[model samples]
Target chain A: MNVPLIARLAKKDVRVTVREPYFFFYLAFPLLMTLVITVALGSLGGSVPSLGVCQDDAAAAYLSSSGAVDVATYPSIEAVREAVASGDRDGGLMAGEYYVLLYAGDTTSSERAALYAAVSSALAAASGSTETVDISVERLEPRGLSLQVRLIPFLVIIAAVVGGLIISSSLIEEREHHTLDALFVSPATPFDVIAAKALFGLFLGMVLGLLILGLNGALTSALVVVFLFFGVLFTIGIGLMAGVVMNSMTDLIARMKLFNIVLQFPALVILFPQIPSWLGMLFPTHYFIAPIISLTQEGAALGDVWWKLVVLVLCDAAVLVMAAKVLRRRMSGMLHLPSL
Target chain B: MTVDNPYKVRNTYVTGYSGSAHVMMIEATGLTYRYGDFVAVDDISFSVAEGEILGFLGPNGAGKSTTVKMLTGQLVPARGVATVLGTDVSRHPKAVHERIGVCFEEKNLYPRMTVRENLQFFADLFDRSVDVDELIRKVDLEKWASERAEALSKGMQQRVMVARALVNDPDVLFLDEPTSGLDPVSAEQIREIIRAEKTRGKTVFLTTHNMAEADALSDRVAFINEGRIVALDTPENLKLRLGRRLLRVRTRAGDDFAEEVLPLDDDATPDRMGALLRAGGIATVHTLEATLEEVFIQLTGRKL
Candidate 1:
């Protein structure tokens, strides 16, 4: 109800956090993780290795058109073998009635096998042979993101969880310092304190989220921002509850380690790709990460991901209400209310 | 003593005194609070008139802090009523809190913030546009206004806390051990501030274990012990009612000095002192009265 009081309290928290060394690390952790992942996976987008073809123009043309490999035509099989031996190409693809893959001594077996399969398939397609099974690969749309780009959503979710830690630590500091007693005596109510703290968490989470997205060159839209906001709110709710329940920084850090395992389910589900979708759907972060990935990587419109967004909002509301209740109870305890 | 009807509620406004029409700034009747099986504050009743300082003097764990908390709306009373500035603290805590200031015994300051920022932050809480620089100067913290609270000494921090309590120019101020640990000079400065608050027509409910502070700064003092008020009256009256008046005479006896005491109320006391002074060996003669601490020990059988 006291708007100015709430705003001033929130601003004070922001200033305090900015002065703390650990806060800077907490804020930059997500961005740093994204940067390391980007650099590590940057080599995955390197140009495809060129392949030497032995006088099979149709196979060479098909391989070149697919863009998965570059075709270098050789006049004879001996010429293709010479090219492979001399390391002019990664490997040589010789197409006849059947396909043969030639490789240097240093070439990996996996690469030789991959090139053989590609050349055989391309030759079969060009020859129009009924002997081979007629198969067509249909891609509805072009690839939306590289492996690194796909990591942006995961990092945003991470930033949100870190936001929770930031808020919890800040609040525990207030308790340890006994400033919370001063706040209670002031015109501000417990609700006002909780609101201000949650707002600070949201603000920090948004800043970190946008910075990570910008670093990865991922697209940002209103819907994506909304999704990130909900994620931040959910994590902040967890942080608020933890802040009220825990009395010391040590306890908070220990509990956050446990919450990390729980909150990481959505990120794990996305990272591994092997986890069942239904299992991921059970988590609140799943709704957040799913929609964010769709909007940021695939350029999906709001209408396409509206259901997930609705679910995310409902989940965040549930968490916030629970956190508010816990905070009120803890505040009453701090006031030294006699238990009935 | 327990009220049969412990929950009897009263109106916010009560009648004033006869001659000067005094308005009650703080009123509590039969206030009680219990911690599980232990009682922190028993059924105690007291009131503070406008522009009066009521010192709640007691030893540690004597329920002084609990009483202050109940009146300040920081804790709810298990029974009885409390009103601050005509607002029922139990029912309208925020309403009461908006008009009062409190300096807690614990140093609850923002360690990372400078002295000026701390005052400015609290002023914003009351939505008041106060001159923070002037407040800092008033507390004599202008030199350290730019320094963080954690970097200041305990005495300096106490001054900042006092300055913070006055940011809103509150109608009522509750100070819990305003000078618990400080040098004589620093303690004197705080005593001056308390006097200034009285001059500004603000009611102060000060809690402390220092008998001298209560005797010097309080218009009236309440002696509390074992979660109950043993006595409440003016400092002079309490000492006079239970304390003996004596005349001390110092004289030279043989190769050493000697002292003798005589009751001032006794008829033969003046003749005895005159005889000792007339003997020409009298070094000094003076009257002695009981201090508040002696009065407290006599009434409660325990030292402050």
Candidate 2:
């Protein structure tokens, strides 16, 4: 392949996309959404739980001094009851003849359990008594990524996918405008055009992936970058294949909807831990998602995720090979190939 | 029941150089192309000499573009032997592409790029440097050099296409309807560029359905219809072989103008014209000659 020609074509593509009015929408919109989602979820996680306490209760004084919860004092027991009933606090604590925990009737089961634990702990501490639970929960594995933190890799993958779609759209535009005819007549071969397009997609994918990672303050390693590169290639391969199969932008969008459904499912599965990991493995993106979360969140070494990386590389190679073959067939006017 | 070779039957005249001494820049023998069962170009053979403009004149879907595509190495013919600039196109398409230029019927320029950038991109493709400013001036696009191709008019875009086709200073330039759908001024400008290329000794294979363009610019014109070439010769010869000579006389007959047609080559033509002039009241008399379009229709039984 002619490196200079490929570079020139890629530069031209970058210039066109950058100058487009929707450049932000195509390249930055995903990262924007990531930022918005990250901020929104971060705020929710940082919110302190509130508790209403009786003014005369010793447990209330101790809980107030703890500063773990937003403590709201009530003038009387009746007021504490009213506060819990009115949903002014998450729950209430009153010390009298018996320790009582009051919560709203509509409180969810998890919230009610949390309120019970807090009241019990505060009363025990006030009474100068130590109470231990009978059952001990043992930890088998170290703590890994938080749900929101793990989502960083997913968002980065999404950015790469969007990059692929943008490249696909650019290729389709070239075909519709008949500029491919001009390139064919020029000295540039079909390999040069394909390589340029693939490299353009790779550049966008890498930049957008790194941008999202940086935005979330996620840890990055050599393995993470390598995995991101392969993930981007896999997604861009889909884009190139789609560009070859579809003739118009309308057809491309319609077809990409189906592809997005398959590709985006792993992101959703990663969010809900109850889903089977093997199910995510059925999709190619699972290889990238699993290893990225392990590397960035679990502090796994490259050797720790060696098997997953192997699968990801194999999948990327398979996809890139298919994409290159299809692109060659299309650009060379061997149109009799069966549609993907 | 095969048709006779029309070029052999007609008296050949040399417009650029003697036939024996002129070098062939492009040669195709029995070139054929098909789309499934439909034949797009069928068993056509022709050659273009160096520094000559051979106009492939035909209506829409007459295999003109297909021929150009094959010659430019865009499409591989199913059964044919074609060479361009001393290289077999099918075996060495890239080598051929480097030495040839092609402007498609459609304005296939990069719409997002400026006129200068568009020419520069193609120039880089050939690895041959070009002076962008001079090319822009040659195509008369200097005023719009900095404008994007999409922002220019169809005529201006066509000028950019022409400029791009000349970026490599190609040995052979294939223009498929380069002047189609352009204003008169733009059309004339493109025609002048073609003439200028001829002056520079660049072989041009111009394809167009405009008979006037072919008559005015072509060193030899080939008339194609239904994927087959019906006749190939100089425009003048094509017109002369199938054209009839006539004398038109206009006279005043009883205060009303009257006209009469007489055969110019007929033995009694002089007698007929003298009788008409002696009758007096003769206002005008002129000889009528057939045009290329008329000759096209007479030979191919189709209007251009």
Candidate 3:
């Protein structure tokens, strides 16, 4: 590794990336979207529960019912009630004497009736009283959505795009000005150039990716970071490959758009929850997004998601090697490589 | 010191070498290239020597740039052979490229980089970090050294290009219209730099349709038409061979000018000019020198 060359290449990468408005947008916009989406989804899904309270036997029985929402138990009724009132519940239950008060946030009339009816039925079954005791249910709106959980995948995608913008623009700009030719003619080896571009792109992608994660920590997970590293490599590889393949800026943009539409989009949607397993397996992005969602949404562990990580790594490696070969061919000015 | 030497500077040959010299730094034999069905450079042969500036003149689609690209290793020859510094340009372009500098017609510098950074970056390309200040000074851009390349004027940018091309102190320099976009002063400065390079004993392959530039700097010129060398010789020799009798005389009749036809061979034109000067108010009497443009038009029946 030529340290100075690496440093110079990195500096050049940094200079070009900082100068580009779209590069910042590519990185931050996705992260912002991830934050927006995660917060929106989390807020919509409601807050996590911090405690629970049962004011009476009926409320306790209702909470314990199969249909009751499971909530983590904590100390103090007022505190739990306050937690519920404040939308802090991940969910919980509450009961009261005589009235059988069910302290949950806002719910539909039908849902309230169902809980009341559940409590009424449980009481009747316990005491052999056909007459039902009157009960009331109340709801309190929570202040904010839990956005951290929802935006993780979006942030990662944003990171990948940031990587794409930084790597692609810099590379293409270099080629357009024929600076790449000058650099290639120098003592800087092909590998040196490739490594410099890949590393620079990876750093930029991760920074933008993590910037989104920073705004909302829920987007970040160990597994996501691990897979995101590979995602970054994949983005940079494709970008450098694009740089090598296309001789002009117009061709680069056109090719980037085409690739994103035909290849990148299909792969992203293939991992949706309702999609069939075989179809999802066909897309590399499916594996990347699935593991991230599993980690942030379902709170899954790395051990459980290692296979997905492996698949992403393999895909990243394949693209990188192909990109290197394409780059070599391009420097030699052989037949033009496909844009995407 | 004696006020002047007896021998006049005009028409005096400054012989640095006593005999025929081997000044060919770049040699091409029957080079042929095609882009799809169109042949860009077809069976062209030429050689450039050290301290020699060979003006590559051609029409718009005449393959001058293509041939320069091949020599610069930007493109490989489809057929025939080329050697730069004993390295086959097609096979060992990297080696040939190391010893040469190329300034394409397009402005290819990184616009975002500061002038100093630009020179520094190119300097590092050769693994030699030059004094940026010195280069900036050389280009007469010391004041704009900290400014971005995009901010500089076209003339300033051209100077920077010349500075960058000299960063490695190359053996051969390929300049494509170095002064095309420059003003008179900047163009003259570039000519001075080219002369300085010659003093340093470097070969220059210059490509341009600017006839004045070709005449001013080129030691010999190769006129390429339709991808073939139609004529190649010294500027004076070509002019002497192809010139017609057209002389313009300026006489003081309120900036009036007169054109007279006369044989170019040595004759009594001086005596006739003396009679005209004695008979009329003559402000200026000068030769109607045929420009390279006229020569080009005469030979190719087309303008560059």
Candidate 4:
């Protein structure tokens, strides 16, 4: 409500966040990893099968004896020959010499073998017709999905969201360095400090999220973007709670590890089950990934996930209220020390 | 030193309290603070007059910080009352906080903000914007105005902390070992700033274990030991009160012969010092008196 106080706090938050090398690494490294993975491993669907097909009758008959490969017959020799050279099949079998054709960029053994099997089957079906039929076929399975496309973006989003983790660490770090006590003595309230930190961390999470979305073209749903904003708020609130509850930096770190195991790891379970309705309603970031992919891949409207959005917003409010209470108690002399 | 001018410290005769009379700024009666079953400050009662610098001297864990925390309304008193600036501290801490400035013993500057921003942040807290340039010059931090707090040396940061304490220009300033962990020169700078605040007629409640600091700045020193006020008086009065008879004086002569021992409280006995000086053989005429530290030891039977 007090603009100047909030502004000063905001300035302080920015300075503290930027000054730490770890915060920067936490903020920047994930996006970089996502970019590297996307560039290095994206679009790698098909690689290889080592099998080969021959245009000769004997080879074609041997392959046709097995029903493993599909072969198509061409009407004319010229048509068959063109199909073979054009990589419609891995190899073409004529009277004797088998010509194995490779796509310009095609490599890896499995791809070549699949192609040969198809062509050999087609030639065997032709069965030495003086009509000079030529055909080739290869059954090569393209990779299910590129590792970068499928997992990198998901990992990046999860990693980037953990900027809130660093916010909690910074709060504890300030306490260890003795700054939090000075803040307590100032006229500022614990609410003011907590709000400042949460807002500061929220801004960082947003920036990192935006960068990944922009680079990968993965974030598409405007509704999902709104979901993400609230998700960030919840994460920041959780971080503040962690910071306020812990007595020291070491305790905070240990507690954070426990939180990661208990709270964050469960999101892994949530991901595999088609995102159960109960989970979608409960976990604030439940729609965080689904909406992103839906928007990017399906061009789906974020309005479809509006309920998830509402749930996340509520989660943010609840967690933030809890965090504010803990912070106030910590700032005050609520923690009992044994009388010495 | 004896002054020809009559404006120096004098014993004022007063009979009753009146409107024009100076009132106590901080008054604690039977103040006791405990954590669970342990009492940190035990029934300590004392009062500080308006525009007074009350030295709260105690060694580590002597309940000095705990007492200060109660007085400043940071910690609720376990038993008894702490009235700061006429408001019950525990009952209305917000009011107390609004009126007082606190510079704690901890090195608690926001390491991310610049020197100027740290001061400005405090200034904004008081509902008034400060001239950043003027504040910088006052703290002698003009050279590092834009440098982040983390970049400055520890002494420099302490100076910045002092500046922050004065930003609100509060009525009462609570300094807990303000100059601790600082070099002598920087410690002197902090002292100078504190003295300047006192000159502005602000009440200063300072806590420290440093005897020289207490002796140099305190209007009245309260020696706290084991959560009790062992002795409370002006530095000179404490010294005079304890060193009753023995007045040891050193003169620039042979080691044994230069020492003059005289009775202090019994002026009626003889003017031995005047006679020695009138004899014209003494190089320097002086009186030996107990320091605040010596007096504290005498009263509390413990070293500060």
Candidate 5:
């Protein structure tokens, strides 16, 4: 572990990966997936939260045009209250003597967030003030959550998956292009090259995972951030191991399809809680996403799920060790491994 | 097409005290390597003297690359020792690597990186300051320095590979088919760089199947086939020892030309030539020497 040499080699790998057109193509999956999902969640949500506006044409027109929710015109503030009270609409806003808002307790936080944005923007426009619009709220019940939040864990984990894939591509291209031979023949030992590859995978995976977290408004928590870090390591370890099994771009792409099925299997299993938790835990990605679901959805603290983090670290160590061994052997004239 | 008289073999040595005696930079004794049950390098013994080029010539799979790999410490010989720069390659591959360079037969440059970036990356690996522009200039590729390696023509890429090998300014260079597939001008450019390396007192171990390349660049040519060194000597000596120089005689035969060949090395050639001239109707006379390929065939009894 020559730090300077490792740093230099890692820097070179990063440069080569960024320069490859496929890196952007490779990264676009999670980015575009996140972008589309987030945008869709913001506008359409799980379903549009309808709001009733009474005697406030400005707020009604503004909310309707905002597209965050459907705004129905009510004849009076009494009608708006009845609509929100019955849960036919998510919330209500009216301008009679004062600006008032009525809320439904059954709406999830994301749905309420969309309603809040639409109501605030509509109220601010109606009052002709950029300052925060003050309004009184009346809730029919209380607050809760639903299935929409589950998508957040999936988005963040997919970003880590892409990060790992970048590592696999860099490793495969080096062997396929025979640049690995060039590296070894030059003063680089197998440890130097493989370590550099692992470092690059970690760096890329962290960046992507952080981006997904930022998009989901999940970066503020230290626990989620730590879990995300180890989660990335877990996936990156898999990515490095994937490189050991691949030599050509076509082969990597082909196997990547299978890897996708394996990586997503655990996430998809979450849809059916009736399936045994141990069965889902059998996959290493479970160590990653389960902690995420616990921390984000269930509000579990570090003490509650610290064991999963340790499991993640162990899994990363095992995968990295296996990846390093096979990759080193592959570079050492193991023609059966990667003769390309 | 031979420009170098005996091809810079005997003079590169240091017997007359112009400098320190040129030591053998590469030596292999009874080196053997096997791929499972098949032998790839078999009991090969050869040495490359300092500042000299030894062309290891063979056909497609004649153990040339395997022998070089053993010498460079990439592959450990199954049977004997490969000493590079007075250190055993298997024992001190890193020690040997810090002072040697190798250009593989495959085009292994990073495709997405610019030529300068590719060269600079390799140069960084050696921990030595390399003037990449000078190397790029040496291969006549100053224009393509900013161009990605994959964007260059095949010859230019080969030149980049050559320049990359020179980045370390190694004392001994092992080039495996640098100009394997190139236009004549590009191939000649690589040959010129090789000549310049010898002039600068750098030992080169060139391996190729092209007999002309072997003849033009090698100080001593070693013919390898079926994992063995069949013949090893200066090209002229090898040709002279196993074969003969001949004269091609042509005479006017109606609308066609009748040709007869005479061995120049044989006795009574002058009488035979004089009698042929006296008989008249001579059209053309040309002298031909046995090529290195012909010498290889004479020794191994197999065409390369």
Candidate 6:
């Protein structure tokens, strides 16, 4: 294994990929999905609501001290209204002739309720009324992640797995262009090419995966990184297999989309309560993100998902082994990959 | 270009075949290959000496490429030995690869990379220090060095492929259809480069169906058909033995010209042609030898 040769090949591939029109588009896939999820779940904010107040020092001081709601003091009542309308604050409270509670046009019903509660409580507590309604909130179904947090795994997969998709497409393009023949006849070995593609895919996927996770505010402990690695490995196998098996770019894309649809069943099962949980286990990637989802979102201990971690490894190994067999068989006639 | 023998065949006058004092660069002994039941390359033998161009001429699917594949160690011969550069090809393919350069018929270059970058990438692969600018200039790609390969015309791209083959300055070069599809000027330019490489003392194995190219470029030509070598010798010999056997003469027979076809190699040719000259007026005489294609057809009963 010539390390420099592999690095050179991988570096060329990265540069080539950057030149491809799809590079920016592929990189934007994670960002696009993140934006969609954020906008859809932004109104469902369970984090402390922020409110702007002006000419109402008592309410602002009370809200700030309450620790349940966040308060931002504005210079004037008009400033509070503008802040609320621009979505800088969730809602606003202002004192003109009388106290007024404001709501933005785009505020969801949930935000409206929170704004009403914040205003009422701040005004009541500010007036020295110690006795007030103590509301206790409980969920009918406990131990479930918010819809926004629940979709982070999906976004991470999208962000990281683009690398594998790029690898597979790059392989097919190489074949069509006959660059493989050029490389094989040179001092470079088939293994050098294969190793280069795999290495590039791993690095690309890892970077995008970490970036997406960070953007989503998902926890990135050692365990999450390990699971992300497994996820990327599984994707690389699928990507290489698809690239090797398909002869044309159109066919590769068609098949990859179908594969992606099937891979998303686990995400669907995790998101929708109506779907059966056991169904997601039928797919190999289910094991890949199951433990990570629990660790990052649910704060579950390792022992709780230890078996899942083992299953993830086994699944990754199985897919990677199958990919190797397929790759070797396909390249045998034209070239041969080195023993990894 | 004005040199009578522009091909610069170093050992053309050497009567002994494949044993010129010059080192043998490529030797295939009874080489044979099969694709399942189909015999792509039957038992064949040939050798090329250093600084010589051996044009393996044949039509598509005539085993020209198959033989090259074996000699290049891309395919294992079923029952023969392919010795290139004094080493068995199959046993030490890597060594052979390091020492030999090849330009495939297909212009397989990095489409997104510039001409200089493409050459640079291969130089890095060989792990040899190559002057990128010099290599680009070798292929006449200096003007297009910074232009992406895809942006260049097919002729320019093929030039880059040729340049890539010269990156390592290997002992032997396997050029498979170096100028398959190109304008006359571009093809001539490529041929000029091949001629230059020959002058630089590089052995070249050229494979193409274009007999004119074979006649113009090869020091020796091998006519391959049906996975077998029909004839292997200098083009002059092949043309003399098989071609130029027929002659057409026109003579006046009392104001009405009569035509007579004469076989130069036929025994009755002297009596038939002499009698015509004795009778007095010979109006016109036209004679030309058969082309390499016609010779190949005559030898193999098939056209290349």
Best by DockQ: 1
Candidate 3 regions with alpha-carbon error over 4 angstroms: A1-6, A34-150, A175-195, A210-224, A241-279, A295-303, A321-340, B1-19, B245-260, B264-289
Badly placed stretches (over 4 Å) of model 1 are A43-146, A298-304, A337-340, B1-21, B277-280
Q: Best by TM-score, which number?
A: 2
Candidate 1 clashes between residue pairs 3 or more apart in a chain or in different chains: none
TM-score, cand. 5 = 0.79
lDDT by residue (B19-87, candidate 6, tens digit) is 458788898888889888999988888788989999899989999988888888778888889999999
Q: Quality of candidate 5's docking, in CAPRI categories?
A: acceptable
The true-versus-predicted C-alpha distance at residue B84 of model 6, in Å, is 1.6
Q: State the C-alpha lDDT per candidate.
A: 0.79, 0.78, 0.68, 0.66, 0.79, 0.80
Clashes of each: 0, 0, 17, 21, 0, 0
Candidate 4 lDDT over residue span A190-276, tens digit each: 556666776777877777777666565444446546756776777788887777677776686677666654444334433344435
Candidate 2: tens digits of C-alpha lDDT, residues B1-304: 2234455322222333334667889888788888789898888887789998999999898889888888877788888878998888877888998888888898788788899988988887787868989999999888899999999999999989999999999889999999999999999999999999999999999999999999999999888878877788888777777676888888987879988889988999899888877778888888777788888787777777
Model 4 spans with C-alpha error above 4 angstroms: A1-3, A41-149, A156-160, A246-287, A291-318, A321-325, A328-340, B1-20, B249-262, B265-286
The local lDDT score (0 to 100) that residue B268 gets in candidate 1 is 99
Q: Residue B135 of candidate 2: its Cα lDDT?
A: 97
Candidate 6 or 1, higher lDDT: 6
Instruction: Point out where model 5 deviates above 4 Å.
Output: A43-145, A271-278, A333-340, B1-21, B245-267, B270-288
Show the lowest summed lDDT stretch of 10 residues, model 4 chain A.
A102-111
> Pairing residues by index, what is the TM-score of model 1?
0.80
User: What is the Å distance of residue A243 in model 5 from its true position?
Assistant: 1.3
Tell me which of candidates 3 and 6 scores higher on lDDT: 6
The model with the greater lDDT, 1 or 4, is 1
Tens digits of per-residue lDDT, candidate 5, A226-271, equal: 8888888877777777776776788888888888877776676675
The per-model DockQ list reads 0.49, 0.29, 0.19, 0.30, 0.36, 0.35
Write the residue-wise lDDT of candidate 1 on A1-340 in tens digits: 6687779889988888788777878877787787788678652233455688866556677887877666788998879877776767767766555456655543322334455567667767787884663332211223223456556667887789877878888888888998878887788887687778878988888888877766665435777778888988899999988987897888887877787867878777766666776788888888888887766655478889999988989999999889877877776787673321
lDDT of 1 by residue, B21-76 (tens): 68899999889988897998888887889998988999998899999999988889
